[model samples]
Target: MATLLLRFLLKAALAFLAVSVLWVGVYRFVPPPVTFTMLGDVIGGHGITKDWMSLSEMDPDMARAAIAGEDSRFCAHHGFDFRAIGNAALRNAKGGRIRGGSTISQQTAKNAFLFQGGGYVRKAFEAYFTVLIEALWPKRRIMEVYLNIAETGIGTYGANAGSIRYFHHDASRLSASEAGRIAAVLPLPKKRAAISPTGFVRRHGNTLSRRVATVRDQGLDACLR
Candidate 1:
């Protein structure tokens, strides 16, 4: 009986891994209709507004703003930013706000495939999926998908939806300041709305706008270019 159970578990694990790899590969050239996060919203009884935007359909400034606001070292890292992770770890040890230091790759993995909240098991799966995406998808595709899938507001998902709902503009026409505002709310979308931002969010958007110029000037965004 023990042997039979072990065999079944192994088979299931293998099947899951195989399916995950194939799924990541397929999404390299294809857009996913929905993601696990969207389903989670439905299960939570929150109706979501999501509009898929290709990288080209999204303004280049928005892409750069996301890179600046989310992961400044996005072009240099593989799947994780060990330095930022170490900083977050030290800060968590001190125990104030308990901030997380997830990279864009890790977040893309979670937003696209996994659930919210952090646990050892969820993190393990997140790491595995992050590796899958980083290895299979280019920096551009990763950004495109991230922009399309990241939750931007309550009951809202994706840049296009957020842009239209908030600024009354399409994502393709988002100005730098508008893009910066959208990027600033990513960390706490449930709490912050880009349209009428709090003082902190407004300042954060300003900083991200400056970082956008820095990333462009430093060639930190060369990977996507």
Candidate 2:
């Protein structure tokens, strides 16, 4: 009985490892066609549309804008940014849920591995997969996955799809301002339209634009370096 139990455990461990390896390999090579998103059901089951854009193919401005808008400490962190997490915790303790400290790596992991929800189990899974992705994939790959899978519009729209739907252009052709605007809508894509400029959207877009310039002036290569 002991030997049988040990064999079962070993097989389970091997199966888990194999699944992990397969997930990383598939994400690295093949672009996913569809992604699950919270907005899908909210918007009448419209699937989240995604377009695969490689890091090499995207403009530096787009990358900088993304980091500036989403996670400024993205280049420095591993899977999670403890500072942001602490800040978020403090806010929550004070009876506020002001900010989300999800890093690019964490977001990538969530988008790729789990369903969206606000629950402890989901969050735990997010953290676990975030660590795995950070260990298995490069920083560039993480950002690429995030940009592709992140919910950028209300219905059946992702980054590339949102870009085309709003600006009438591809994500690769997006200017800094356009990219900033797109990133700005990320926090409230379902409730807001990317093309329509609300006060909050405009403010966020302007803030992102300034940060993007700062990122560029400091040199994007410097962050990676």
Candidate with the greatest lDDT versus the true structure: 1
lDDT of 1 at 67: 85
TM for candidate 1 is 0.95
Tens digits of per-residue lDDT for model 2, 1-225: 999999999999899878977887788767655555644454665544556677677666677878897788888878889999898888878984478888878888877777778699989878878888777777877877777777787663557777888888888788888888888887777766668677888888878877888887766434443
Provide the lDDT at 18 for model 2: 88
**lDDT (tens digit, per residue) of candidate 1 on 118-203:** 68999999999999999999989998888888999988998889999999988999888899999998998899989978798999
What is the lDDT, from 0 to 100, of the residue 210 in candidate 2? 77
TM-score of each: 0.95, 0.86
RMSD of 1: 1.4
lDDT of each: 0.89, 0.76
Please list the residue runs of candidate 1 whose C-alpha ends up more than 4 Å from where it truly belongs after superposition: none
